[model samples]
Target: MLATPSDFDVLIVGAGISGIGMAAHLEMMCPRRSYAIVERRDQIGGTWDLFRYPGIRSDSDMHTLGFVFEPWRHEKSIADGPSILEYLNRIADERGIRPHIRFGYKVVSADFRPDEARWHVTVELADGERKLLTANFIYLGAGYYDYDDPYDAGFDFSEFEGDVIHPQFWPKDYDYTGKKVVVVGSGATAVTIVPSMADKAAHVTMLQRTPTWMFSRPAKDAIANFLRKVLPEKVAYAITRFKNITMQDFSFKAARNKPEKVKQALHKRIEKALGKDYDKEAFTPPYNPWEQRLCLVPDNDLFEAMKSGRASVVTGNIAKFEKDGVRLTSGELLPADIIVTATGLKLAIAGKIKISVAGEPVDFSQRYYYKGCMFSNLPNLAVVFGYLNASWTLRADINSEFVCRVLNHMEATGTNLATPVLTAEAEAKIEDDDLFDFSSGYIQRGKHIMPKSAKDYPWRLNQEYVFDRKVLRQGDVDDGLLSFTRAGANAMMAEEQLEAAE
Candidate 1:
């Protein structure tokens, strides 16, 4: 059965942080430009609402993580999962975006029509019923991970007596009180959960194949909190946000420039935190800083737990999972009643949705990215890929603003369509590189699935927020690369509709 197709000027997929942020921007910037957001899950918060694992928190500071328009109010910049979800919900409700959201709709496919200058989006609902939606423009905020298809590290723990858990789909009712918990993997999740679960569990063991760079920071931003009390909310937020961003930018550049010096300094910090008894070898990572995400420990919580003898770090390859715990390749057995796999997310490009142009399936890996927000040769479509170094919202904020500008530009001109088409010569000249330069287990596992990046501007992943802001926010939209055209009657539809609405 052909479902009722609701036509919108713009269609946003996923009601997560990025989608919601974009939706809010559309309302504020292009108020007359009608749009609807489709969320796969029933809930509004994407990762924040989904992950119910203990001690789930943002790796970056909330001052920068929070939306540019609305500053983070709380002192605790490194907020927990629930708090972040609450913040997103508040933004949705206050912006009157909740009514425009169609929950339980998973985008299955998007087919663009060059003739009509429109997209026909197909989404599957919870009841297996599929609906066809039409939109002039599509902004996919469907994050860079597959929530449904979590990355399985393929640990041979099939015969383990105790229950095994993945942080991606943490059970709501499960309790780990008084249980000996063994957390697998040494990414952000493992580092976070170890300290959190240690409080309730008998003891928590962080089992890692390799070490990650762990840096301790204050849980609360005292300066930001103090400024909020003294100055105007917006003023305080702006100052604090810049301060954090500058520090982060400097630190990342310094690390990249002097890898050994940065690595030694990081090791020294970890050594100081864990004392001389702790194996410094276990704290040293093989890869250089920024090659993988730097693990953030708020107030040295993870280290403090390890120092108190409540939590421990075990660096070894798992031989197999025994009835009680996991056995290492070195013949060491760590006893545990529960095992938590903190293996990183399965990196997804545009939420696994099948896209086609004129009935031909589009190969995203072949397509070049245009200024981080869009893809070359993809018409009227954009995907929000955030910063690999700084806060995700930093890039998201710029993306939303750029999208608004693009829509505005389309309306100003008689053209209703725009697509970034890379020239054959340009494509041939640009050297291809990994989409994300990180060497983490999950990224390495899914590197084949990720896009091949180009070397220069409008194609490469800069990894810096500053470069994105300049290119995406201030760069010319009608640059020679992007081709804009018009359909028959709808050529002036954008301008007309906006005028009519106004």
Candidate 2:
């Protein structure tokens, strides 16, 4: 892997969970390949660094959220935002992944030159200068949620007197102590904030358009703790990871197959916690479980808060923001000193980076993902979008390994460019599947701009991590559909051979 004019062999965008994991894998596997990561933010720990709202944490357990190569040594399975950030920071420090990260490098555009076998990327630097860098391949691990543009509920709060806030940019010094708080939206953020804010707030209300499915799990995983006490670190971690993944898969699959049974069981437990005052209709969603992600409440903190009368839940539409608080469509006035709009995230398709191949801009909506990593007909470009149903890191790990395998294959075959080539027949067989099968507000809002998927193997997203892990990890690298060609004189021989065969 001799160095060339193209700054490095590979350029990875974003230092988030996916990006960090990708960098780790590259360093471990393709040690000789010169790679650098460009992060728009000034710091690492992408999600854990960006979101700082009260009680902001992973809905997924730490066992799976933790990287496959690393074992989570923490006692709490349901970790807080700060703890997660610390974990990520520890990983970067221990693995020496920090030096390879170029913070404050916001990539605005990436143009691939097939003839030249290189990608010219333009990044907006902190000093307002546009820097053009080149790389042989580009891996977009920027993540899906757009922190810049959180989904605005379009509420006209000009008439209101309270402070409006969004969880994406929570102020560090802002105080809500003894203040009445009303959090809009029933997703994970709302549930988390309600319990956390209720500790000191005069009262907290979770206002929602519709109820989202919520499940309760213990904050501390007893089984994992016990196993670690007896078994070796690696051995205990492996067993715990497998158990959690299996349970997650089973829960999701069972929900899909028998949503009613799962719904009833969930409602029953919530009802028990909420007591007789629980409005079953208000808490019941029209959609089935897993249609949207199931919100998780560790140790029933939200329910405990509600039961203690410090917090409550209200399901209704907003008429307008009144002088004191939000006026429900039913004319119920929920007074609040502060309103946190935990509405949802705005999807950043391809990290909002302008990507082009041979001067033609890539319209991702028309392109289907190859094995949920590489885009169809896109050359030397791969995106590590993780599983919706499981830990995001799970898919990231698989995609990163697959990228390494592709790199190895290219080097073995002496190919400069690798592109997923689809025949007319293959394209015709493509099914119009959503890139992510989620019903969250943010996802539905950006549905039109999302990438497409197919019904065929590799092209069709299995959505399950187990299926992807098997295929992507064990499958052949020199697949027929993935076309590779040498840069200059060597490519002529490949064309000649193809022409002779026809």
Number of the predicted model whose TM-score against the real structure is largest: 2
Which lDDT tens digits does candidate 2 get at residues 125-185? Answer: 9999999999999999888878698987788999889889999999997899999999999
**What residue pairs clash in candidate 2, if any at all?**
none
If scored against the real structure, what TM-score would every candidate get?
0.95, 0.96
Model 1 gets an lDDT of 0.86
**lDDT tens digits by residue: candidate 1, 414-476:** 677777767666677888767777887777777776666777787866687877788877789
- Candidate 1 positional error at 118, Å: 0.9
For every model shown, the clashing-pair count is 1, 0
* C-alpha lDDT values of all predictions: 0.86, 0.87
